[model samples]
Target: MGTAPATAFDTEALRRGIEGRDAAALLSLYTDDAEIRVVDRNTQPSHPKIVHGRDQVGEMLNDIYSRDMTHHLDRCVVQGDHVAFTESCEYKDGVRVLASSMVSLRGGKIARQILIQAWDE
Candidate 1:
């Protein structure tokens, strides 16, 4: 098969996908059964928003795309099949979010991901 995303550009692809609101490119990095857990100001540390499979992920991404927001990737690190990054997103409603995410990759696709955020409430 192929290798690990052709030297880390895949992470950048994810960054661009989010900033550009391109759900297809963003979801392309995930495996079919990939799961994402998000814990933020709305979501509690005790109970995170969990998404299973590509369909759910796509739906969630679409919801995010529907929002009038701007996304920026601040920093990223890829090491030993794990990737981590920090992102900031600002919405037209004056909500600003800073998220830190960690992901596990399998066969060049995201197998699991967790995102924790701090935002204006």
Candidate 2:
């Protein structure tokens, strides 16, 4: 029998891919029907940018990959098929963003992710 896919979150690979801004690598970890909700200072708790499916997610990923910045997974906690993590990023021109995410996995791929972020003005 084929071994089941790993449900455990691979923090190292995830961190490396994000830090390097490899959108493809990031996308590879998501399911085809994955959804992502993004909330920032502009998009508050009530109103979030909801990205549905891999195609839309790909666009968002492309945007991230286009940015000239450094990414780091500051902290992470995982239980079962869920994970929560804080991300720190410093972009060019001295802009810094701190983000936190709660993610759910399906079939070892990210099925949903909710993110909240804040950037220095």
Q: What global local distance difference test value does model 1 have?
A: 0.86
Write down the TM-score of every candidate.
0.87, 0.91
lDDT of each: 0.86, 0.88
Cα lDDT tens digits for candidate 1, 1-121: 8754533438779888878988888888898999999998778879999999999999988887668899888998988789999989999998998989899988768889998989887
Where does the lowest 10-residue lDDT sum fall in candidate 2? Answer: 3-12
Candidate maximizing TM-score: 2
What is the Cα-based TM-score of model 2?
0.91
User: Model 2 segments beyond 4 Å from truth?
Assistant: 1-6
lDDT of 2 by residue, 1-121 (tens): 8977657777777888788899988899889999999999788879899999989999999898778898888998878789889989998888999999999988767899999999999
